[model samples]
Target chain A: MAERAQRKIPDSSRRSERSRRAIHEAALALIGEVGYAKTTIEGIAARAGVGKQTIYRWWPSKAAVLLEAFLDLTGEAAGAGEVGGEGESESEAYAIPDTGDLEADLKLVLRATVDQMNDPRFDVPSRALAAEGIVNLELGTEFVRKLLEPQLQLYVRRLTAAQATEAGGVRRGVDPRIALELLVGPVTHRWMLRTAPLTHEYTDAVVEYALYGLAPRP
Target chain B: MAERAQRKIPDSSRRSERSRRAIHEAALALIGEVGYAKTTIEGIAARAGVGKQTIYRWWPSKAAVLLEAFLDLTGEAAGAGEVGGEGESESEAYAIPDTGDLEADLKLVLRATVDQMNDPRFDVPSRALAAEGIVNLELGTEFVRKLLEPQLQLYVRRLTAAQATEAGGVRRGVDPRIALELLVGPVTHRWMLRTAPLTHEYTDAVVEYALYGLAPRP
Candidate 1:
């Protein structure tokens, strides 16, 4: 959250924690149903069963509420059982597994992403933010920088490791940042545009195509 | 247009043509300025100096006006001087140049696509439609089927030709439909998310990586 809770007695602190979770749940549900344009702070508060002031005191605006809600959803979705150290957000704890098999690791993570995209809990609210972000530059850039880029960076980190050490690794001439997109962009494009069904089979093909060239090998 | 004008004498036909052009211009400008949600038929008519009745006479909704306007813009941007046959829209005339040199041909098309994404004439209105499509299934699916899928098929056609004959052509194992996404997706993901500056240099690299494979050549 942008603002921290004030010093409080134990009883009140527990109440505040409950309110925060409720507000996050409410924000997610509301955005899923009505989209960002139609979603309002008052509406979120009403659905959350908290006072309007309660929302404002914790968040600066509706966008903030949705963003925090999204972050929370992403955290729960990243339930790999590893916990972040105190003061580390769950996002920090999330990392692409470096299993030494680049192809295997990528396929595993990408299949999980496909599953997340299919999950309405993440998909609906994510679409709300992505739609709004397309038209609203500030919000779009914020989410990309704060949320999306980090996830993409995990791919970069993995590919970079491969380039440095693996046999038949990613080409050294390639930029890991751009190369990561080859894997990510196809899955995301399919999901965002609804051009085709996003499936484990499709993602496995993407991984196969990206790692090995399309052209016949010499 | 969804509705054809009533049978017109030459003088009236000329005037109708002028009104159609004006409405197209108005729709493009208004959607860019106000976005899809705020843009309205009354606003478009007011800007075009046509009666609301005149607009309603031909198009069913603002979405229709914008779709045609977009088609016209795409046609103009595709000003390769090859006009479609009678009764064929310019979209039909559009094709990935088959120079039989797959790499050069793809680079040429991707470069043009990058130019199109940067052109505010197409970019602004396209984003408006895309943003709306994320949340509105009917419109999203309609635009994809009518506008985007046809264009993507052009790439599929080019790739299929490559697979058939090029010496180092696409491997027979690769699916042309999925393969096209690897080429198209990265450029698009970067453009839509604003993660990085989309340049000819970036697209060149994408083509290189997608064709050659990120994995080192054996």
Candidate 2:
């Protein structure tokens, strides 16, 4: 989380924004270099060239700092429209670009997601956080509620729209929430598990298979 | 894994089998209680009431011990046909009941998988190991190859069979390996990420959606 954004400080405080960005970058770099367990607030402060008290005043705990840093990184990514992470602007961040072609729109978004997950800056720290979340239930639930679920909701909105559209809309009785998973889940499994290479071809295959059933198409 | 199993020692040696089972139980119990990082070989030995050398002799590292222990637990579950884990008897363990219906067979197997994941004995330790694997790339890769991939292969073989069969076969051009992810990945995402309540209702929906495209029926 950008401190200024969260605190509702005026944009005039460029120095504070610089500090927040440095801290975010430091937290991410440190976590990526050393696993989540080893990351420390003091260490982050040192790395960011800020006093320890500065960090303490801003964030409550190391987890909070890391969580916010992650959110900020994703928010920046969303701001640039580089990948999957949505920004504070819900409408723009979550919009799925319904090009009147559901398949094409989904492919576009998912392909970008594949790129985002593969990006080193995002992948390394995200994996560390994700690893921690798996064992740490409280942290995991918070991560899901705050980060992952909101992103998934974007898909829900897009799918819901597709349901209403006449041009290749979803079939009756299909749940948008669950249908979105068929597309998202496979990519996530491959990326997280490292079971296979996550490539455009793979994402394309996933989108195709998800839109059309695996059994022979009648 | 199990040195005794590999050595083909006579089944008459009940003492050795007992010791191995004890160690496996201890490792799983310790990891589930304390998390993976705190779990040690000495701890496992003390808990099992066996000498430390016994564990070291059988497995090279804590990871190996936990891996094999998990394997044993799941194998036992598979032997009972309680869940998805395949037993030593590949044919029986891997077999998806070929009742001439592919969809039913997939659903039956996936539902069993949900049950296995939900089982406390499996869920707790498995989560710890999975958590460690996420950050530790080497460990994660090993876990996937030793534990996850083999189980996935069972799906691959079953799907291949479905492909060949004239009745309820998968459509041409669907890669069994990738197609299997559609079924397995969503459930894993839910189970691992704790996105929502994993239930038969959810698994059933997944199966229905995966087998039938989301697109409207003509």
Candidate 3:
């Protein structure tokens, strides 16, 4: 097993990683410039200075390439906050903090989300992909399942942890899944529709409205 | 004033109305097939069997044409439910029925929404426009202002009414605007993402989850 693992890590592995990063950047840039339907595998390969087979060997389709590229982008962004000496883990890259203070924790994460949404680096490509997702169900579901749901589940975990705590943390009967939507949905609506500007203020409002009922608390 | 109003209704005006309806239908059809960016005023006029000047005389842009076309379609749908009784104003056509039962009213409207979301006639064209809106901010804001917000406001009105009532109803402190998002956002999320099959059952669940605090009720 050790020998097989060593063999998998070829001397060319570092070159492969560089090629992969180029391919991902090219995919995102192309999708952002031209819409998704017009973005072809050959186009991405040409932009990346890579042979088409290199991308094909890694991803089956353009959608797969874009999805993985986005995933990689999000992972890198999340990794920036890593407290050194803990060694990076997948959980550190994706996990929502469960600080026992559900409200404060949720507020912190949502504020970060507001900042991300405002950043053109994230927004432009995401909007392009989302535009495609609006019309393409197969692609939409794949992206949602792989990218969106995992992030949403982190909220679920945080909410569930809140539910488990003694004293009135979260209401017991609350389905964490649906409850999380109350937090996420409004922000998404604002972002997708461009009905309003997304800001820390707006996200803070959403967090407040979701946790404490919009109706006057008795 | 009445004589002037009558004189304004020329024979050409009547003919223009017919041409306008035809143009709207053509725009919707063409957009549904080729999508918004590819959909053109000339194409719409050609499909409608009208002169390009006829379309130009009526609307400034293709976006304006599509927006009016959608508004007309919604108006027609709402009209079908009207019994054509005396004093049934235009506002009545757009208003969500307040049957004094907020939950039931919301469910009925949302169930109808589920049907509309599933219907190919509405879904196909809507997806095309929505896809364009995702990337186009000015067009998107126009859509939200003219179309989406009016519909959302109906919920705001209903929630406000519920809050005003003395009986067990929405809490007064609840901002009707934000309160409405709780109900609308999740359904939109499901429909837009195709995360799951949208059904009356799912909408019912959203309403239930929203109204009865997810946390255990005292």
Candidate 4:
């Protein structure tokens, strides 16, 4: 009886995992198509081919589902590189590379950012969420707290490490927190405003200009 | 008869100007109240106490009305400082001051930006418009071209002048266009994201960090 119970438990857990993935995919797709204001738990459940109660059982709100969906998507995108080697932890996939070259490291991540921003899969849904964030202060704060700041902190960590290294790339007094903004902010502005096309070339230019200073270096 | 006709024409022109101002004010108020999607031409016309044809004659669409309304508001804001001098041209209001000190000039402009972003008269309608821009690319591009890029170019020109005046202050090879972003991007990021409060102090910090380099100057 004990052996039978153990076997049933693994099957149930696998089924639950499948259902969760389906719900996340459904939530992302629905929000992309209809936008945040119109997306609902019922809609996600319908699209996922599951009952609404099953969705409710897992997530209390559409916002919660969408948030997790984005987190999952980011994880998957980060996992595409060699960081996802077998036996590596999940956190490894999201880790920003630390090569001790601040400029090159920033450029590499930003180039990947350019790709992600341009990708329709990411862009459409992100725009939907961003539009909602602009109007909804509560959701916007939650997004910054949960999604954006965590990613920004990875840059902060890298910059802090750069300061400690003896190579002397960044100035000692520079605050890594604000320094990261000089790198990330421009790309974000171009992306959000559609002022220009965001490309790897553009991202590379931002990194170069930021590191070298705009005033002619004496 | 010719003199009488000319005098009558001026009177009619003066009346038209008043009506135009009323329409602009109405458009801003309505957009702020109902947001972009719900705001309509008929609504603006009603609020302005003008016929739909009058608004149609002046603007092609609601977006056009809102954009021009904002332009008119900015013009008024600029002219507020010009009250004592009849010789001041509209161009003077638009020009960023070149005080031979880049950091001071940047701080002045960014402080103005902080004030503009915080002003309820500007913030509510601007937020409504920005939210729409996030979702509508064609509209977003048009809005940025008509309203934002002109303002950004002023910074580019000022930065270029700074580079020329103080050769060692900015790198010669730096693109002023991209370089200006390093200054403006962080301010906008903080404002739009609400990650921090927008203040003159924050603007000063951004200018200092951007121009001087985050690293302690050698």
Put down candidate 4 lDDT per residue, B44-121, tens digits, no spaces.
889889999998998899889888898887766655432334576444457677667777777888898889889988
Put down candidate 1 lDDT per residue, B88-202, tens digits, no spaces: 7667787787777888888988898899999887888788888888888888898888878887998888899899985737889799999999999998898888999889999
- Segments in model 3 whose C-alpha atoms lie over 4 Å from true places: A1-11, A80-93, A165-168, A216-218, B1-16, B80-93
> How do the predictions measure up, each by TM-score?
0.91, 0.89, 0.85, 0.88
Off by over 4 Å in 4: A1-10, A81-93, B1-12, B78-93, B166-168, B215-218
* Model 2, C-alpha of A112: deviation from truth (Å): 1.3
DockQ for each model = 0.76, 0.68, 0.44, 0.55
Per-residue C-alpha lDDT of model 3 across residues B127-169, encoded as one tens digit per residue:
8888899899889989988888887887888888888876535
What is candidate 3's CA lDDT for residue B108?
Answer: 87
Per-residue lDDT value at A114 in model 2: 87
lDDT for model 1, on a 0 to 1 scale? Answer: 0.87
Q: Flag regions of model 1 displaced more than 4 Å.
A: A1-10, A81-89, B1-11, B81-89
Look at candidate 3 and give me any clashing residue pairs.
A171-B215, A172-B216, A174-B214
TM per candidate, chain B: 0.89, 0.87, 0.88, 0.87
TM-score of chain B of 4: 0.87
Top candidate, metric TM-score: 1
Query: Model 2: residues >4 Å from true position, as ranges?
Result: A1-12, A82-92, B1-12, B82-92
Clashing pairs in 4: A171-B215, A214-B170, A214-B171, A215-B169, A215-B170, A215-B171, A216-B170, A216-B171
lDDT of 3 at B102: 76
Q: Return the clash pairs for model 1, or none.
A: none
Worst 10 residues of 3 chain A by lDDT: A82-91
